[model samples]
Target: MKQFFLTLAGVFAGLVLFVIVTPIALIALAAAGSSAPATSPNTVLELDLREGLTDQPPTNPFAAFGGAELSVIEVVDALDRAGDDRNVKAVLIRLPEMGMTPAAADEVRQAVRRFRASGKPVIAHSQGFLPVGAVMSSYMVGASASELWMQNTSSFQATGFAADEVFLGDAFGRYGVTADFEQRYEYKNAVNTFTESDFTPAHREAMLSWMRSIYDSALANAAADRRQTPAAMRQAIESGPHSAEQAMALKLVDKIGQVEEAEAEAKRRAGRNAQLVSVADYVSNHGLQPGSGSDAIAIVNAEGAIVTGRDAGGGFGSGSTIYSDDTAAAIYEAIENRAVKAIVIRVSSPGGSPDASEQILAAVRAAKAAGKPVVVSMGTYAASGGYWISSEASAIVAQPSTLTGSIGVFGGKFVLTEALGRFGVDLRGLSVGGEYADAFSPTGRFEGQDRAAFAASIDRTYDQFIARVATGRRLPEARVREIARGRVWTGAQARELGLVDELGGLHEAIARAKALAEIPADRSVRLIRYPTQKSPFEALSEAFGVSAEGAQALVAVGGVLASPEAQGVIARARTEQLRARGASVLADQPVR
Candidate 1:
């Protein structure tokens, strides 16, 4: 009987080994057999922005097993490559109904314009312009294309912008819930959603300022592209919710047709018998990483909230989170590598843990100390802890619509004992060692002393934040403090205030990094991606007998659980933004 048990154990161990080894070996063989992608003459490149946008590439390579949306940076890199390719005759883009932060819209638009500069005709189309749950960002990107086409069933959905908030104060009060929170300054209104029924004067003022700034810039840029004035753009926008025929009449859409019609037009422009090559297929064949081992500029993408420790992507309460330790390691790796000459830190975050922000900030400083020039390319929102890590960069670049700045701190916890009591639940709190042990306990409310202590802590952190910015940006302490009242600023305003170095997108940020690194303007340097992303074999290592087919099935499951559906739910949870433990130094804008 003991011998039989031992034999069973051996068989189990062997099966486990087979499960891990077989799939990896197969993936390795496939990768080894892969060849360079080839482009045929008169081929039209098809780029689809409809797959939705991601600030950066997949943190878990195996996470993209089913299919993937190319990160904004990846899209720009493809355009750069396709622009110079001799066989690529033109480009076709799909800008369907999608959600994009204004900054992302601008960056992709910039890439499309760059492609046009290469004398390649680029056409953009939409299945339904401004469909339900989409944004005007899609239309702005379409406008940047050489020509824009809309479907017959589509309509102009450039509904303009409005800032809104969901106040939970009254709702919580009805249930006897009380929030015990405080901020260092008036502009730090993050906790107000739970404490106030309506926006305070200060909160209303800040939202209007930034929203107006974003809307105006987007309006002006759209008009400029279409050869119209800002006033004309404003007038058209006010008359929005236009039908397909109205869009054509207003010159907002060039042609009204179906997907087939759009493709036929692109093929005609590319010459007879032109074939369409998908961006995904072309990238898969060619790869996105720098092929050469020579001088390179690493693109260190830092998206989502900043937290301490290394990152292991896609887990509960940690979707799209950026771990400072992982970011630091990537920076150090770039610095230590002799092949890398410069680094671009692409940051798109709303700030979370201050300690994590500091960790990333220290790493950026170290890179500069190691003779590696660093540039920060800000995306949709890089306020608070996001701004904290970016303050120390060699220079900062942002799109005109990027929301940045918010140098203040706010922290506390809600007391739900009363609310729970109404629901026939009783709770008690007991603490022995520390005087402030019950400070964060949800069973109790903040006592006067506890509130004061928490406020003081926030004040100290705010001061430290301001001092760091002043030192890094070479501005006076008073000047930094002037802008550090927990106020948000648009990228255009930040640039005007000297908070940002320039107003541009990732492409321009790369140009600035190249210039700072002393790389010649005409020289083409390979873009090195950081941290070396992983693959399917690594992700599904523990699964049994998983073939390529099995891998796809598993990937689909993982993607569904972790992709758009989960992200959308979190995005809509304005009042309860998820963060790591000890996120007291929270820096982020109020829900829009």
Candidate 2:
């Protein structure tokens, strides 16, 4: 019997060995076989602006998975490198379905113009032309293109800007649901969508004015770049959508052709035979090697809600949360690295955990203590915990329409006892521990001292938040509270409130950081991005199998649960839950 068992065990071990070693051996053979020059060697980097340029949580999965999105710095750096690279002859700018913010569009336009000045031509292509947003059909930026091509069958759709608001008041009324929220700012219209059928006059007026400013700037830039008058571009925009031939006649596009034809034209202009390469591929090939140099500004981005602790699944699964530990560690590494001279905190979050916020804030402080200037650039929405980290920065820059500042906190328990009772299930417990032991359980209402204790803790955290902001912004505690109370504000309003120092975009933030660091404007400053690091082996493993790193995250979370830090973890989790629930109540404007 023992001999039979040993034979079975030996067979199982052999199977396991084959399972592990077969793939690696195959990969090695494949790698060896493909060790040749790239087939499409001479490349024309294509920057296809299909989605909205955002620093916020990506609304679309394509942007995250397809890797088609670019941050402001990423776009600029690509342009700079492409312009200088002899192998990269020209650029194909495809704005087939762009939905970028005005500021981001402007940055790209500026970069395009700079690239063109290098004597490298840029060819713009679109499937169907559209002027739906300032970024989509900015005449000012379009003007910079050496040639604009639209599909032969395509037509331009130039609908003027409109901010549509969706209200749920009637829906809630039918369900007997009520929304109770407290906010300090008159412009905090987040709750309006829940309470009103349409925008209030104030909201409409504010939104329109902001839109107009952005559109006008875009039009002016496009006109200047395209060598057309603003009046002419405005006339074309007002003429509505046009067929390909009509667009060419109206000087809206240079020609009518397919994407391949446009690429060919670009190649011809570059005076070289080149293959078109995606921007990501080009960056992968030519961008700075990670951790290679000392004079670099690492951009550490935390684009979504900052939850506490670790998140399994790389924070990519649907409804999965952002892990503050991962983000903070990224920042910490950048700060500790002598290779990174400065840090850019690009935030697009609607806030999350107070504990996580403090964790990040401490890291930012540590970065400063290391003599690294940390500059913050706000994206679409950076409120609450987002603002918490930014308040510690040496300088903060935001676009005029950027939503920021929700200086408040709330916490509550979710009671499911009645629902369970209805289902004929009951939970009874006897505990010898403290009252707070069951503070977070979903089955019971937090009553008596438990409720009071939670509230007191929240208040203490709030006080700390205010104090931190006061120190960061150089404002008194009382004055900060005046604008606190979970109020949200637009970038312009934030600037007026002294919450942000300037009204600008990412480039401006970088410039400010460079100036603070005493680097000359003309001198080159290399940017270094943090976290987003992976070895070729790791990448291959991810492409083929479940990542060991993911397993490690689960183990780490389990360890946290088993340790003394469990209380802090639980508190942070509760804070994140509140923030997630309160997000809709704290937006300065309605999400589209």
Best by lDDT: 1
The true-versus-predicted C-alpha distance at residue 127 of model 2, in Å, is 2.1
Report, for every candidate in turn, its global Cα lDDT versus the true structure. 0.78, 0.67
**Model 2 segments beyond 4 Å from truth?**
1-42, 51-73, 101-103, 130-144, 178-213, 227-235, 245-250, 288-294, 313-322, 399-402, 406-467, 475-498, 501-508, 520-527, 536-592
Candidate 2 Cα RMSD (Å): 13.4
How do the residues 1-592 of candidate 2 rate in per-residue lDDT, one tens digit apiece? 5544554465354333234333443443354345433425456788877753444323222234444355555676678767777777788987745346655665567678779898878888877745555434344455578888888998777545555678976665555444433333344566666666777775676566556756665666667777789899888867877888998898878888999899888777655566878775565444432323336777776777788986443222223234688778888899887767788888878888888888889998998998999999887667888999899899898876576887877655434555556567785666668878877776666678986787688778788888999999999999998887666676777888899998776667878887888777776767766556443234333433546565334334444444445645544554454455442223222111
Worst 10 residues of 1 by lDDT: 574-583
How many clashing residue pairs are found in candidate 1?
A: 0
